[model samples]
Target: MIAVPASAAGDGRPAEERGAAGRPSLWNIANVLTMMRLLLVPVFVLLMFADGGYDPAWRSLAWAAFAIAMITDLFDGELARRRDIVTDFGKIADPIADKAIMGAALLSLSLLGDLPWWVTVVILARELGITALRFWVLRHGVIPASRGGKLKTLTQGIAVGMYILVLTGPLATMRWWLMAAAVVLTVGTGLDYIRQAVVLRRAGLSAAEAERDRER
Candidate 1:
């Protein structure tokens, strides 16, 4: 019997990498954008807390930094896919950079007393927990991000951006509703991810057992 390479056998490498002969460089635009987002996390935090943590001008600066980071995130993955430059570095760092920027924003807002501590804790817990779950089941299979997950991320970004800005009367109330929607999406999508991971792990284990039986 001929042996297949692990990559070709889909032993946890991304589908795109299977049967591919060439590797992309780590210095591609996608990775650069991800790194930029990671760097902006600290800048956003500093600007968020500047001037007693409530100055409109400083908040605006922080919001600009955040907006830029989000924009880069939107572009980076598409660029990587279209250009066939999806490096392993990009796959790992992109998600970390995303969580870092959003985590910093949520935590900073809570510390400043702008957002409720519970909101921050819940969002952060979901984000971190999902990430850890991905790694936990990584050897089994890669869970592709669902459309609902993308929607959840979009809602989170917009809601968090609204909270970052100083608003008045009706706008403030609207932001609250938006944030409520974000929380709902966060929890809902997190549960969905967990379900997918469990299914993937079970399928992978069953497949491995079948292969062992065949070998014996």
Candidate 2:
């Protein structure tokens, strides 16, 4: 009698099954949520500018849309990581969705004279620069989110929400303060991510050299 090897037995399964086990599905719940966030961007912009930022009803609807979109950002990431359904599509689409929503809100506010253009320029520069930096360092390693990065997101969300709601009096003053805090946090975290990229590149080089030494 002849004995078949276990490896050969496993290889006898269909290619589709093997691929499914090794790679994440693109049409999972997490990716759907990310796509939904992207879809919400235009809706948010339309609602925000429908009445020239004057009518309370339109402003309220815009705020609701923005809030829902932000909530999805939180859950989509959590679900992806928890369910082990992370994918390259999710990695690329997630940040684009986030920046799109925030950018729409900031640009609308500036155009309506609610926010200064300078604020929009600074925040956007940081976001786009960091995004480019991430792609540049892909050969090295991923930079995980730090506590400061999370704080910056939170503060920026709150500031944008307040701005969309178009609050007046004391609430208006509070929004400026929140935005100031967000700006500080955003700049600090941007610098930190650049530093982390340098460290990760050096570590990757060291590991590669050590592997060569072992092979020799």
Model 2 lDDT, residue 78, Cα: 93
Residues 50-165 of candidate 2 have per-residue lDDT tens digits of: 86776778988999989988999999989877766778899899999999999998998898898899889999999999989888878878888899999999999999899888
How far in Å is the alpha carbon of 27 misplaced in model 1? Answer: 2.4
lDDT of 1 by residue, 69-132 (tens): 9999999999888877787788889989999999999999999998999999999999999999
The deviation in Å at residue 82 for candidate 1 is: 1.0
For all candidates in order, the CA lDDT equals 0.89, 0.87
Model 2, C-alpha of 185: deviation from truth (Å): 0.5
Off by over 4 Å in 2: 1-23, 206-216
- Identify the leading candidate in terms of TM-score: 1
TM-scores of the candidates are 0.88, 0.84
